[model samples]
Target chain A: MILPVYAQVDLTNGRWRKCTISAKLFEQYLGGKALGARLLTDLTPAGLDPLSPEAVLIVNTGPMNDTGAPSSSRFNMTFKNVLTGGIASSNCGGPFGMLLKKAGFDGLILCGKAPELSMVVVEDGKIRIEPCPQLQGLDTERIQEELPERYGKLVIGPAGENQVRFACAASGERVAGRCGAGAVMGSKNLKAIIAFGTREVVKANPEGFEAHTRKWVKQLKKHPMTGDSLPRYGSAGLVSKANASGVLPTRNFTRGRYEHYEDVSGETLADTKLLRNSGCVSCPIRCERRVKVKGKDVKGPEYETLGLFGPNLENNNLDLINELNYRCDLLGMDTISLAGTIAFAMELQEKGMGDFGLKPGQPEDLLRVVEDVACRRGPAGELAEGSKILSEKYGGADFAIHSKGLELASYEPRKSVGMGLGYATANRGGCHLNGGYLALLESVGVISMDAQTPKGKPELTVFFQNGMEAASAAGFCLFTMQAMIPGILFKFGPASFVCRAAGKAMLAARPLLSQIWKCMPWIMPINCMLVPHSKSIALATGLPMTIGKFFTVGERSYNVERLYNLREGLTRADDALPERLTKTPQEPDQPDTVVPLDQMLPVYYKVRGWDAHGVPTAKRLRHLGIPLPEEG
Target chain B: MAQVRYHGHLADLTGCRQEALEGTTVAKLLDQIKRQHGAEAYRLAKRSHIIVDRRSAGAEKGFRTPAGLDSLVEFIPVCGGG
Candidate 1:
């Protein structure tokens, strides 16, 4: 039988060892984020500096990955975040994961720093580390171009070389953007990792898996959220919804509305700038925007890049946003964190605490600023540390716009309180996906519950978080889960009685839903159309997979990350938003317009079976089959 | 009559940012706009959410919500997912 296997590389000595995941662990966790988290918790040393050689980085693939499943060409990277000082798992859609798996390994573990700058290559189940001094200091695009085209490559650029706190690792045009994974590679003196192979994935139930993939692809194409909106405008389509709902982060999140929102909206991008819509491999929803940057075509900005760089900076220029996004990508810096930090710097200048020469609605010198941060030059060097450190040095902690040191995304959560709660409590820190992306239901999607209300948020947040966790762990794009809302809701509109009933039903089912997590291992039946992942996983791995077992895996993954953070000294105090988000109302006239985090946290903790201190109870950990931290 | 504001592509279909439409309910107002703009607006409207006075029209009652004379109704097309 084909079992999940991993390659452990000791970069310090250039030695490689291969090991198989025990059948028990394989059955309990899928091979992506869930398995990566499990390995991280077991192998990662406690209290090690995230940038140190002792800190290990794991890249893992899911069972469906490269198995001809729709939108399954994604990978997960788990490591300690330099910025958050907690567990980090970043996902990306690129050829690297597929190549890695096809090369006869489900995952790779990198430990110890290289003695010199080098590139690690894996081909035909063999691993080799080679010195590549000539490639040092090159940008991501140049490095990618210089690498052999036959092999899939992962590379970091100047931002990572400089060890910018939120540097990213790029694979093709896709990036593992959040959590400084690139910086960890840089610290190890690794420039890139390439994978090449000529083996086909072995599936246990090939026919069943093939049937599920076909049905799933058709379902994904038929869904409006994925098939229509995403394919047409990519993620940039949310600009108008965020703006109209008063949730668009403008001018360092001081306001939720932008006056010139349309200028940088997805509609404008589609009308004026879009070359075409692109996507990852096996994806029916081509939600990638290909637009011109400089004289050449490049991947365009997503909503986070557009919103943060556009309205959040008070700049109405989509062209400038695209250029900056390209710059961030090439430099290996995360656009979300980069934009959030710049917005915070702009606010710092507005407060007369410091002058970074940044201003609202100004595009001048922005490109220069991006270059400086990537190279760690002058004031940009300080800014490269992220907003959290800058806030500590300066005094705008209230308006720093970060959670647990990681910067917030474009969604202004004061309006979407569940998203606010998500930012505060996400294990990876201020991450939308890790925070369960409840804003899609509460504010953006057709499932319009009350955006500002905290009622049902804790339960809904838990439900969505668990569901997203399972889907993400199964290696499907979170966008694939968009079909779960049912297409009828979109057809009838959010104003229809059915949509309202749908929202209310979710709210009303909170009690039952809260209990479902514990009962998951037995109750959930497998289907490809609704919850297709379980059946897909079973057919692919020959494991006894069920919808219930899948939910258990998600729960275990989340709790494992939380326990890792807890062991690393993160507490409930760290699970918080900036004062600006909680204390200052988005609408000056409306005192209650701020996020009601205080009201939601206790309930959220209760539903998660955590203590008032926000740490999971021993009973809860035992119930999920996760090990309790030694300190706990 | 209610002042119905259109956003995103919905604005392009209706050819006006804001229109004064005669109807007692949001449903009737949307029907009038759909009839005037034809299938394009109808398709966009079906995918869009109707908000009355800055709040959700609470999907259950949808167009049945009272669009009273001075209400500011919005046809904000749904393009959410990032």
Candidate 2:
């Protein structure tokens, strides 16, 4: 089997070199975030400023990328965490990953600041760092328009150029939309990277892989979560479910339910505004919504944008949200961080602590504020620093609604305590997907596993975090994992006795699950129908992969990231939520409404084989084939 | 009398967002919904996640859970994360 090749580009010297990882290491890391994390750790020093010239940025693809696997076109970007000051990895559904592979490279390792504004061009295994002063200060769309349409593009906008703390990198309309990757690009004076090639991705067993992928795609199409609900409503469909489950963030997370929720709901979007549905390359489940914004069709807001910009701001207008989503994307800003920052600023105004000329339920100046934040102009410029810094400058740290300096997603974790635990313990700080997204089972998905219960969450969180980490490294969309939930469960429904029993059974079986998780590769020898990723990887890459080994890779990935974070000086204390979420209840009469993070932290640590201080044990590292700090 | 709400596709089938219905329990409220709307609407409602007074009905007693006179009941379609 041919080993994956990576391009190591030095912006300082304007030179590049080709590098390859050993087959053994490839099996262990499995590419994407895992491989990126390992590469970043090896290339950079501890406590290095994420935006410094010395810091490394790795944009990479998994073995499944560009292959025939469904929703397999995802690429990952990893750098030092610009938000949390730890390890940062963001995934995007775009053509760049496919094109990069076709260009005879699996990844790019970039270091040093360019002497001038530059764009890296990769074509058929050759690399060039060309000056692109003409593309400076261009919005994401304009930059892409200026480039060749046939080439896969990854570009940043004004927010990135200005170093907005939550700026994102865009590839088409999809984004690696978290942890300030765009700002790092801007700091390096890199404007964009474009690639084009005609090479084909090879598979170890093409026939078997194709058959497996076809069956998997069929399963996704038949599943209720992927096939029907997602296609019909997109992710905005969860607005009603989140609202009904009392997990919807409202009024800056002070409340759980929104009176005007349906006004900005997925149902409403589909009924009134939807122009069409779209999807990423090689994806069978097309969950993206297309809506008309200012008479032009653009990408619609996801649940995070809708929840944060809608009920969290007390703004019921759906049209306004679509416009905001488009505007943020154009500006290369992260909507979740931007909206959360705005909500915090609004709350500050409410408390009379400061005046930012923004208020909840009053969105007249929102458009201006969005631009101001992107440009870092006026008082709104303070918001460009993000909520953590704003809270430190102001005095609302208690209600800041972020963990490890990154703002939480839309799910009001006070209602779904498992999600709350997830927000607190996630490696990337407040990322729902990285936190195991237990909110799926607890609040939104067909399984209704007592949203408020912390009983089995720690074990489940570890299980899912590991699974998702591995799947992402394998280059599949997290949405594909939704198919793991059996169709029979959806038929029974959440309200049915069978479904309720299953939820309870899961919680009751937590100890066994925890043991199974701890046992690792020994417990699961075969690929599971529920999880097709392991088999897919084995068939595509000639790797000896199984459900057990797949999860072990995920665990290794998680630990490697943890080690990076630890090396960067993050500790157990960094795994934290704001006081408001941990201390204050959403409902006054309901004492149990708050997130009991303290109760679950110990259990979570223990389940992950970490010590009392949340440090990965030396024995655990050795068991996972991970080198210790000194050894590395 | 309780305020019964339909969300997502349910509202399209019921032709209204919410209305006052006579029921003392969630099961009874669902029955009232079926009587007012049709079997299809009822099936959708049955499959949905029922919320009473901002809490999941499943978290309480499922279909048999009590719905008081002033209760605000919502039937929301199940959905996945974005």
Candidate 3:
């Protein structure tokens, strides 16, 4: 197998250089976020502004990308986070990653500012920086439409151009939607990136890889969560379950239960608005929902957008959510941050703190405010700074729903305490997937784990965070990780005694799991069918991959990002949820409903082999094969 | 009598979104649904996430959990993450 090659593009000089990664580095960091993190650490200095021309943006693909692996079309963009001023990595599923690999590059490292509005084009391994001043101020869709159809496109819109702090980069309808990668692109005056090539990705054990992938695809198809729930209802399927479990954010997270939840639910959308179901390339679990917006077909809202824009804002119109989702994507903005920021602004108006012509359940100004945010126009443009900045400018820091400057996803973690812990400790601010998405086990998935208890949450969070980080770095969709939970468990259902018993058993086995995680990778050398990721990597790259090694890579990846964040001056205090989640209970009568973040944080640090200060110890770093930073 | 609500496919199976049911406990509620809708609807409803008075029945005593008058028993279909 060929080692990964990265193209270093100097936008200012309009020159590029190809650098092949060493086998040692490839085996250690793998690709995607892990590789990007390692590269960023080496190339960037501490305290550099994220929205400066000196900021580095790495668009990367993993070994599995374009290799016919299920959900292998996913790619990652890593840069200095504009929202948090920490290490930022965002993943997206689209044709860009696949075509980039085909164009003979595993990644693109962009630096320096372009002399003018520009587009980077790579065709059959030839790279060029072409000025495209005419594409200025266009929405993401219009920019893509202007580009050649055959080239896989990654473009930014007006929000990115305006340097909205929560801006995102668009790849077709999919997005690298969190941590403001688009602002970094716009800082470099990059309007778009297009790649096209026909090179085939070669695997070390092609036949073995093919057979394993076939079986993996079959298992994914047979699994209840991947096959039925996701494909049928998309990620929005979690709406009813989250609401039923009291984790749905309502009225800007002041309450967990929404009175009119049924009106904005996944079932309602599927029944009323859905045109069809779609997905990323090579993915059997087609979880994308297609719906009509203003007589044109577009992507539907995910659970985050639906919950945050619906009940969180006291709105029950599902059609409005569809329009907002389409509008946000077109304008190159993240729906989670945008909705979260809007909700914060509405609450500020309610408190008579500051009015930005926004209110809960008021639809008259919703579309206009959204457009103004993207264009950075008038009072709504203040919202472009996001909730953290708004809270600083005004008051109500206690109710500002963000951690480390990045806004939280729609899961009202006051009820799902483990998810709250994940949100607080997640490397990339308040990302659910990065924080382990424990809500899947605690409230939404087959397991009905004790949501309020912090008893065994730390260990479980570490295990999940590591697993997901590795899966993402390997270029598989996070949805595939659902198969790790046996399909038989889903058959039992959440109400079954057996299912409840399984949840308890997992918590009970925390010590054993922790020990296993800390032990050497050689402890579990065998490849298991339950987790196809390790075997897939072993076959594709001929690397000595195992379940234990796969997790270690995840652990290494997470630690690398944490180290980068630390280098940027992030401290233990940065790992925190707002007072609304940590101090206030969702149900006033239920004092224990609040996320016991204090109780969980110490345990979480201990489980992660970090000191009480939450700084990773030298022993842990050495064990993970990461070099201790100079400060350490 | 408790107001029992069904969500998603469960509502389609039971042929109603909500109704007043004669039951003092969750087990009795399932039996009532069985008599009203059919055995398949009863089975599906049994597997659902039951929320009584806005709290998960799974967090309580499951089918044996009490459902008094003015209780709102909601059966929500199980699904995966966002």
> What does candidate 1's lDDT look like per residue over A122-154, in tens digits?
999999999999999999999999999988888
Docking class of 1: medium
Give each prediction's DockQ, rounded to 2 decimals. Answer: 0.64, 0.71, 0.66
TM-score of each predicted structure versus truth: 0.97, 0.98, 0.98
The C-alpha stretches of model 1 lying farther than 4 A from their native spots are A359-361, B1-3, B15-20, B59-61, B66-72
Clashes (N, CA, C under 3 Å) per candidate = 5, 0, 0
Measured over all alpha carbons after superposition, the RMSD of each candidate to the real structure, in angstroms, is 1.8, 1.4, 1.4
Ranking 1 against 2 by TM-score, winner? 2
Q: Pick the candidate with the highest DockQ.
A: 2
Q: Stretches of candidate 2 above 4 Å error?
A: A359-361, B32-36
Q: What are the chain A TM-scores of the candidates, in order?
A: 0.98, 0.99, 0.99
lDDT of 3 by residue, B1-82 (tens): 9999998788899889899999999999999999999988888788788889877777777788899999999987777755
lDDT against true structure, model 1: 0.87
Residue A458 of model 1, lDDT score: 88
Per-prediction interface RMSD in Å: 1.8, 1.2, 1.3
